[model samples]
Target: MRFPFARVVSLVVAVALLLSAVSGFFALFTARWRVASLPGTQQVANHTFTEQIIVGEYRTCVTLRRETPATNDSDVVQVRREENCYNTFPVNLFWSSRLRDVSTGEKAYFIGVCWINRDRVARVLGIPEDVPMQSLWKRQCFGVRSASVGTQAVAAAMAVIGGAVLIFDRNDKERPYRGMILIAGLTAALSLVPLVIWFGVVKKPGFDVGPSLRLAGFTWGIHLASFLALTLLHFCHSRSEMARYSGPPIDREVVTTQTADRLTPTQARAGQAAEGFARLESQA
Candidate 1:
């Protein structure tokens, strides 16, 4: 049993898209898990609670001091003092600010960290017994989630289009169907858009880093491979079409010489007479 070249190309494209989709799903899963594991609150001092500090590229420690109201009408307040616990050689991304609690009307400060090797830093710093160190901040995880979701969506589209092309398009002669080639080229070009955004816009130093970076990289690689396969298939189909239309091969020099010899009526008659004489000689 034989399959058309167009069908084979479409099948390959479908497989490639499927792999890219799988990678994207894995990346999405990892991002969600990391975000869920972060601590919601931290104990700043005795009998007090505040939002947990987010740790990113830089390590930090916060100390909270509670203050009593001076007058009966005054409200209680908490003071926060932050110190750089340890600075890593390679700086990562971090965001820190105070947020007001909607329910209790208390202010809490949180720190978010991204792309830092936290375990190694913890071991090296020998964190103090009192200072709480948790790797809770990851600003880039959200970007990873966005990129992964976009990748999955694009891959799914590619798979559907490729499968349709494989099923509906058939080659009539030497070349794959022109419609199939056109659709494949369009799909390959469209697929590249998400990858460009992922690498150029979404995958940033502070926003998408760490383990998510590895997953994003793998997803991008699959996408690139799929595009290249589609391009090669299109090139092959074009070559086949050209060959089909160009006509049968002949010795150009021999044909040209024979035609040139027949340009004059005298040469043509002399050649005919030579052929008749050679036939008579053979018969004798």
Candidate 2:
């Protein structure tokens, strides 16, 4: 009853954290789908160009069609297309890229294609020999893949830690849980890394940077909102707790009594004489 405001603020923070956690989980999976479904391969006047797309957290690849002269005697041209995504191995999650071709309306599956260290993980997974390895490590390692994973992981951790703190620590003394604040801050910070990489490092010639950057910004905004809301909630609860803990107001009567008790014997006698003189003068 003393800190009713603290209790209310803590309850609100807890509810917000719970909702954030639930929504963050869904957003993680949705982000994977959205990134994977980005239009990678496009046809323009007999030339098909594909941009290196980051599908999910751990996979990155590019697909392009190559044209070559069929025979030396004749002037006939042959079209060769290498349209398959790669898994990059050692960090493979549950999801894989199964992109469909826009022009031919055919589906291309690149489930177990390993680029780096193929002999190590490929043999263990028992992937068929037909799956080719398109190991373009120089271009694929643009740091966005790892940054995306880091951001998502931090966001999930923030949600969990914030929710726990809000539920257990209902009365904030001066600040929220230091650990929760640290985690939320880290989540907000990590969310910006991918956006920076997208605009600065990954936006190269022939790459579709618009849609990818937009998606990254959207996810980053969610993390930032969570961080700000949790911070405000903590501040409100802390102020309420401080008010509750502060000492009660002093009583005027108690102050007068204490002052009289502390007076010297000479001062007490002089006060009595002054009172008697005042009474005598009133009578005269």
Q: Which candidate tops TM-score?
A: 2
Look at candidate 2 and tell me the lDDT of residue 93: 49
Q: Kindly list the per-residue Cα lDDT of model 1 for residues 59-166, writing each as its tens digit.
A: 333222333335567665545433323322122234444433322446544443334454433322233223334323233344543443555466556656655555
Model 2 misplaced stretches (Cα beyond 4 Å): 1-56, 60-84, 89-144, 172-175, 209-216, 233-284
Give the alpha carbon lDDT tens digit for every residue of 171-228 in model 2: 4353456566666667667767766755565443333444445655665666576567
* Cα error of candidate 2 at position 209, Å: 5.0
Clash pairs, model 1 backbone: 54-111, 55-113, 56-113, 56-114, 113-137, 140-207
Q: Estimate every model's Cα lDDT from 0 to 1.
A: 0.47, 0.53
